[model samples]
Target: MNQTRYPELAGKRVWITGSSSGIGAGMAKILAQQGCKLVLHYCRNETGVQQTLQTVAELGAEVEVVWGDFADYASLENVFHQAWSAFDGLDVLINNAGIVTKSTALNDNTGAAFNRTIAINLQAPYRLSTAFAKACIDAKQPGVIINNSSIHGQQTCEWFSAYAASKAGLDAMMKVMAVEWGPKGIRVNSLAPGVVPVERTAKILAEPKMAATWTKTMPLQRFGHVDDMGWATAFLISDSAAWMTGSVLTVDGGLIARGGYPARE
Candidate 1:
């Protein structure tokens, strides 16, 4: 575990959604190192969440675990209440819970998968952020929101209709939330990561040809690590980004910056 650089964040309360694995788990670990009290959420994956809880606890964090199915939208309010009351109230809301539904538009003609993707990826964050913002306003306290977005929101390829739409909506809604909450001292922002290999993609992304193909398009010449996202999240919530809001912090290692041009010699 890394040492806490932002001592100011010590003792702050945070709720991280989908913390059972991947980027959410990474964020939980990082926030734990920062000495933040955490409310970790998971839809399922009890084992994974427990592992995350144990790891963060080992880092000396006061941690709690919660669960909710975002697809059942009506249940989110109660879930948010539970998380809020875990530590009295939360100081930060990391809307990191999402699904990556990759299917062609034709395959999703019924829009079931598309709707499900929107529900979990976009609607859940919207609902959760709204709850967090209201609670902060009622308590008359400043707050922060970090929406875990994707490069697909800005640029995309095929088989991402549902995924892209949800992320794009998230980014737009994040901006509006920032605008409305700015005067109230609640900051909203999106963290757009590109080509970060998590547990789900690590094996495939590690293949020599696959690794070379992806990294070649990125000027940084390497895939992103979960820790990179952890650092980025810390910065967003830290005083370092006090004045920043309604922004999309792109941590893509130049993947999007390079565009579709062929690799140069």
Candidate 2:
């Protein structure tokens, strides 16, 4: 509920994937306050999506909800189409749907898990961005695409090989898209957030020692909040960042700057 206004966002149409909860929901709420027409996407969490829709609606912004399975290419295509059709055009696309699974590179079954993770985290965003950009080009309208990546894309962490690889791929894709689409007035970028407490990370954040260890290493001495990511997303998509494209914005509370060092024990 930080009421910072972005006049540039007013009346814009935005599509956010995996917006039922977590960072996506946070972005929806913040964008709604900016008077943006929102197309909120959710895979299976109807309840969560409904809650998000209600929150945005209460904020008095035009909003709608849609569902799609990222693992299915056809479904993913339909998602982009439906989202774009929701407002007759999409001014921004937030590729926020992603998955992180616990897997080791040495595991024999890692290939399946890796492929699944990539399909959702990397391929889906790639396809969505491509479609959105093509549509913008056809319509002669400028657009923006923001991919929700992770600190794991650039930093190493154990048992997250598949997840890390997917995020890294996403970052690379964002850069490539920016270059290819920039001339058409389409901007593409990635936001890499670190250790935000959401339903997905609930169990990990519940561990006292683990939480303390992470908190101590961060120069900000805390994990990121959903609103932190939300506000950043809004800014990046706004006209204020018109010159920013093909860049990776890290919102990690200075965790990456610590160079993976542990707190002094």
Candidate 3:
């Protein structure tokens, strides 16, 4: 179907990491709706990713599933090759795969824990973006890489230092690439989403006490949906945001608009 209102991503080759569930899955669906050819990259959730691929297939998208651990760089080339074999023309790369094990304080952070966090959230995306960028440049096609980032990248969290540091690096990397790849038609940016309620956060949000606390504390008094983040990403990576790059677009529900202090106990 020809898109009149939307930028018609039909046939545009799109590669997404962390696409098994949550915001990544949601964005995959939105991209499918726009007729994109999708490469869904998931970490360990094969059964779940197959389900996502089935749904995407139903949407008339050309779909391929690739499994590559974000912490393992050796397997990245395999993923790129597998997807590229089918669709040689790459257009978009969404670095959405990341991992965060909560630590309440820097003292709580072990060397192993910090290493794991940086490896997956920060280092892997940087490596993958480099890999994807090189491929797209070699193919001589304009590409867009949208990093799935967090609001914490812009602000500090009390107990989540590991997660914060990884995201901070991600934010810095995206900015550098916007300048490096812009000359080649590759736009690099990040979606610094606040709390998104989905499989990833559904259980936590469903906890009545936690939900109530955050709701009262959060300025918007509500949690954001994965679709909210996904749609914004769709726009940013599309021609609609053709002029946008190196930008950290926030989708928090007025969370960042107010003072950082939470509601008093």
Instruction: Say which candidate scores most in lDDT.
Output: 1
Between candidates 1 and 3, name the one with more favorable lDDT.
Answer: 1
> Which residue pairs show backbone clashes in model 2?
none
Worst 10 residues of 3 by lDDT: 1-10
> Please, what is the whole-model Cα lDDT of each candidate in the order they appear?
0.95, 0.91, 0.83
Runs of candidate 1 with Cα error greater than 4 angstroms are none
Q: Give the TM-score of candidate 1.
A: 0.99
| Native-referenced Cα lDDT, model 1 | 0.95
Q: Write the per-residue lDDT of candidate 1 for residues 4-95, one digit (tens) a residue.
A: 88888899999999999999999989889999999999887899999999999999999998999999999999999999999999999999
Better of 2 and 3 by TM-score: 2
How far residue 224's Cα lies from its native spot in candidate 2, in Å, is 0.5
Could you tell me which 10 consecutive residues in candidate 1 have the lowest summed lDDT? 1-10
Best TM-score goes to which candidate? 1
- Give the alpha carbon lDDT tens digit for every residue of 1-265 in model 3: 4222345666788888888998889888888888888999887898779988998898788998888886876777777777666676578888888876687765664577778888989887887788888988888788899998898898866767889999988999999999999999999999988888877679978899999976886777898887787688778877789999999998888777675776775
Which is the better candidate, 1 or 3, if ranked by TM-score? 1
Which residue runs does candidate 3 get wrong by more than 4 Å? Answer: 1-5, 105-110, 262-265
Roughly what TM-score does model 3 have, to 2 decimal places? 0.92
Candidate 2 TM-score to native: 0.96
